[model samples]
Target chain A: MSLKPTPVSRASPNRAGATLDAFLRWREASIIVVAILLTIYFQAVNENFLTSANLETVSQFIAASAIIACGEVMLLICGEIDLSVGQVFALAPFLMHFGTNAGLPIIVAILLALVACGLIGAINGFITVKLRVPSFVTTLGTLYILNGVTLTLSHGSPVETGGSEAMGNFLGASPYAEILWAFAAVAVMHYVLRQTRWGLHTIATGGNLIGAAEAGINVARIKIGNFVLTSVLGGLTGILEAHRIGSIDPLAGGTTVMFLAVAAGVIGGTPLAGGSGTIIGALVGAIVLGVLRDGFTLQGINAYTFDIIIGAAILLAMISNIHLGRLRRGGGR
Target chain B: MASALRADNIVKRFGSVTALDGVSMHVEPGEILGILGDNGAGKSTLMKILTGYQSPTSGTLQVHGQDVVLRSVDHARSLGIECVYQDLALVGGLSVAHNMFLNREKLRRFPPGMLDNGEMRRRARQVLEDIGVNIPSVDLEVERLSGGQRQAIAVARAVSSDARILLLDEPLAAMGAREAALIIDLVLRLKARGNLSIIMIMHNYGQTLDIADRIMLMQRGTVTYEKAAAETSVPELMDIVRREYRAVRSA
Candidate 1:
């Protein structure tokens, strides 16, 4: 009996076209192309745009947002969001500062701060999943509560974290230190999201909660775990930033950081609607924003213009992502 | 031959509404028991109870003649009861292999909870091929598949899990004739294996008569009739259904 050929044929002539098509269809491919083009344009406009020192500075600036984005990507994939991540980012550092002044060991202080963030994450998860409250509302309430507590505790002033000099050096002495943490978060998170059962469950939870539950997956656990993961990552980013910057600024990570991290994830092709996401995509998204901001600054563009350009870029990326997703479903050419 | 599954007087109630009223049924090893019911006939509720999606209000469930309490779908699965739901319970964003191994994923030795994707992919391909499913790749996401292929994948997933008793809820619903035929053929092939017992809930009497060894007709949360398939005819089942409908309309 003659067997019928499969729909996805692998003939040699079609293979070449298919390879190119696969590249074009990948969500990150367009973003990479845009980043490269932007780099070329920046190089033409300014001599210092491609300098190693300048690149290092860009990496330092992007690292915190990148770290937060890594967590946000996972949460978003599981069909939820944490608007309070920005507050956790600021609150964690202040908690650390208070811990150090209270005579706790530095590592102990950091752990306490992270624990606080984890508690907040648990609260968010409990309210959202158990109480059936919308996550957007739950996290918004958390954002205010955390912001209020941080402001009241620090009295809206920067706390001088008087730690050992070795601690400071170890935390953020090298320009690459914070960037290394960001990359480490990305690498670890990427592995968890792609190569683990936990990640698969997360995707399934977001894709179809009822379906996943019927399949014997613990949907609540997956969602709650993601919330905790995002908040802990946010707290860690705050600690690293505080150590690098030499002080815990009360108002350091406001809604701007939260928005930027969320935007990075969205720009990286992680759908806000959930079901699908990638950590590597978020990392590249952070770099794209970093390169844009750095290049525009080098070209003497006003800082205010950065907002307009970045906003437009996010919209464009979203449009392309939607189209690419449709193409993958064989909806349109 | 011993029975594979036995549901004794399964009763389900949601507040004042009674969904399944003392429904008792059984399927012998390798036999296909066809459940025939209309809307609100408690067909789905009974399936849910058997599959551990929901607990029966009051019932004794037996698998291989041993009484067991299924606390959850996972528990049911552990007891070798696997269900292919009408909606298919598939994650559209996940690849075919990933969806097949949804909660029962294989972990790598080194990473300790990491998915063994390569192994899963290989096994998924082999299982689908062994089952004679004509799919190009297991790497493709389920959303890209046609309705028939998607149904096939769901059945393949259930069967590959070593389920001794398979519960198919409206497997041929909303499917084209060819797709329905494909599923029927798959079901027959599984029956030929002789280790698996099948309980298929279907709407079509003729189709049910075509594949089932025994036929069960349910109406208003109760079984109205049960008979050997060879002893019952479609017109006889239709007359019984019409009588139930007339009684319901009068009530």
Candidate 2:
């Protein structure tokens, strides 16, 4: 046999060309462009869309959706979902109420509520992973159970909670507190997803479970960790929403909010099929959702029309992203 | 010279089924040992035992001629034993660099748990280059690569992790002629590079002879015949298999 080097192409010879390819291949780039266009379109349609007072409403929408989407993105990348997260959201404020009534400080009560949410997430993970149930089924079961528990515990009615003004302002009553929390979630979660070993393992676990296991990754730990993360975020969203409204409602952040958070994630390029996702993209996706809702309301479009638009828009964005990805790879299955 | 890996008197049973019975094999340093067998020939079971995916019921394993027991896949890997299964274990959604690093990503010291992706990419490229495997970019996801390229990456990953005893399970099972040639070339290159011992559990007789220095034939959970690849002919191996089939039928 003749000893000769097999001719194989080295890393793309042209640096600039490689950079262009990476930019095109990045799922977030196109989504960002779409988000910007939507924001501009909304600002144009109604001057009130960007007004400080109206912006507060938009920020609230973006904040809640983005925070939940951030958590869901991690779970989605690892091929799990928590339909119960919204229910956890409703249960948290009530948990805090119970804790405060039990003589705990308001901050301690809130922490306790978050911890309870994390435990719920752990249970979700345990049931799904150990019981061999598909996460969709497991979380779906927990969703209704938690909702029922919240309603039963709350006596099927909304109640107001009295906390210090500073605590109220710190939580969500301030004009931009929730949005600030959302940005922090996006920033830190983005780091965890992209820059940490946990994030890489999560992607690998989702991409191929057996392969990840073969590589000695603790697959159960990664999945369970993500579940806890998502649930904690859900509980926090609930607490923030409650404080923002100065009332704890048994029906807060129900299926509607859960679906919106998931929609934000899916729109931001995290396929429900798993394997890959982006926190920053999810944040922008939430912004897109917020702008559409706020913009449509300002234009006197009814809520029903808004739903139709959102559904169609998500489908369109996802379809385009898929096709564009294929095109970027020069086409093929 | 000490064998890179030695499995002595290995036996495995799974609840009333004897998957492997009294199987023994060894590969010397820098040697490619091919285990050719038909389906249910205990090839996979032996490979599993060798890779620590399973422990033999009664056999002992030696790495670098030192007696040791492999507790798990991670244990086997730490002992410089890596298996590239038929599935290749490449996560298609990940970039080439990420798949190469997988569970063993390099982390930044100061940030505490943050990946040093730049360093990883650099090392990934260096390793791939050292192995003489090349592609368009390390940033490209594994799914975009052809089957052969993906296989090459899996092998390169093993090599990068410093695997001394590499097991290739059905490395050529589903590949087309060109892709098979690509892997054959890769195995040959790794052999020429020295210090890495390979045991290929394969099906094709001629391909095995071409790539391996020695061949061991297994049938019904035991090695039926063994010979230097240079001395063995395809007809001779086929004749042995036919004789075994005839004996089984007569029994």
Candidate 3:
């Protein structure tokens, strides 16, 4: 006694297309379209937007940001946040600073940085998930502490990693390295969130923790893993920046990256209120932001003006993404 | 087959308020039991206790004729108990196949440590097909599905878990007319699965009578009346509910 949800499955071509269109989710479609449009605009304005040189830069920026944002997206989707990213970004390189000065191999230094950064994430997870502290407050406190540690380690001067050039080149400066890494990040996360049970559990954990627990997900463990991954990604971004700019500074990575990361996430159609978002959409959102910023930069615009523009664009994207009034691209029924 | 689930003399208190006082109920295998109550009748509280969301201060809970203790949701699920919350609790962003396999996803450990999507989609499609759920494609995301389809997917997801006892909280609360009929039919089909037992919490009397094999009327944290569906009419049920389940009218 079951009737088809849709009558006439093989009906008119137009109707079938409409039915399919109904299924393309709004946020994902909009983010991709926005990313593409921004790319086209930048390409038209300046021959630089799509050139191999600028393309490498885009890949590196996305590689760094995507690594951090992917974790944030998972955390946000699971109803958590990490405000300590900038600090984690700064602190990880110091692990290299100390490890190298102490006569360790560059590989050991990088591993130390990853572990130290991961520990910071673990503490955040403990306070927020285990101790029942709000993530907003807990991570904010961690931001200060990590910043302090990095500053204390740096002693208010820049330390250039001249000898560790090989390590830096392998992870940060290698041409097209960012593209491979970005592709790997998106592909793996897409697979995890879509193909693996852990990915589903992560989404469910963020969507409705209570419901997920009832459904048999280890919510605490998932949140902990998300927090740790986010921190590690931020650390890697810091290391990449240190190599690209040729020095490490506690004050260099600004507060703008955090806001930018959060904005890309929401614009990707991942809600601030969590439960459902896609990794591909996240990459699209980041590209949109990067293109917007780079496009304005190529036009000889001031850096600060681009911030105002980005703020406005992000607000608009959020409004459109949040309001589900019309048919949007990348949807499904 | 004595009963799929049985709660005896369940008593729960919430810091000076008695949410469930001497509450007890049973759902025999192959029967659909509808729970009716007015506001503050402790309907939710009783269900929570049975589903292991909350522990009853004083009560004995049994599953499939064995004395059981439910310390957490896993404990309940291991005993074949599953709850379909009013929220439907499905992630809207993920695909139908992804959501269907959520919390019970298959792990693929080949080709350099990544989630295996092909297997996940295959399994999700099989679950949907086994539950008689047909759509344009199982690979489509859940956010695009209609409210009725989402709800059906949820119920199908629940029963697909090898659960013998299903607790559906306000399954028809927000559904429109056409949608409500579809859900009732789905529930009836589930009842025909003899090894399964269901406890449906609803406000719609017509739909309750249409699907439930027995009815339990609850009021002010207590069960006032219990009768087979064949022995009761809407008006007869209404009168007892009006007089005994005063909380509904007052609230």
Predictions' DockQ, in order? 0.56, 0.44, 0.37
The candidate with the higher DockQ, 2 or 3, is 2
| Candidates in descending lDDT order | 2, 1, 3
Candidate 2 ranges beyond 4 A from true positions: A1-24, A331-333, B245-251
Among all candidates shown, the one with the greatest lDDT: 2
Residue-level lDDT of model 1, residues B23-57, one tens digit each, is 99999998999999999999999999999999999
Please identify model 1 stretches exceeding 4 Å from their true place.
A1-19, A331-333
lDDT of 1 by residue, A1-333 (tens): 112223543333587777777787676887788778988998899989889899888898789889999989989999999999999999998998888888999999999999989988999999999999999999999999999999999999997767888887667656788898898999999999999888999999999989999998889999898899999999998888888888889898878889889999999899999999988888888888999999998878988999999999899989998997776566212
Q: How well does candidate 1 score on lDDT at residue A189?
A: 91
By TM-score, rank the candidates, best first: 1, 2, 3
Q: Ten residues in a row with the worst lDDT in model 3 chain A?
A: A3-12
Q: Look at candidate 2 and give me any clashing residue pairs.
A: none
Task: Give stretches of model 3 more than 4 Å off.
Answer: A3-62, A130-134, A173-183, A267-269, A319-325, A329-333, B109-136, B176-178, B205-210, B232-239, B244-251
What lDDT is reached at residue A165 by model 1? 83
Local error of candidate 2 at B42, Å? 2.1
Clashes of each: 0, 0, 12
Question: In model 3, what is the error at residue A249, expressed in angstroms?
Answer: 1.0
Best by TM-score: 1
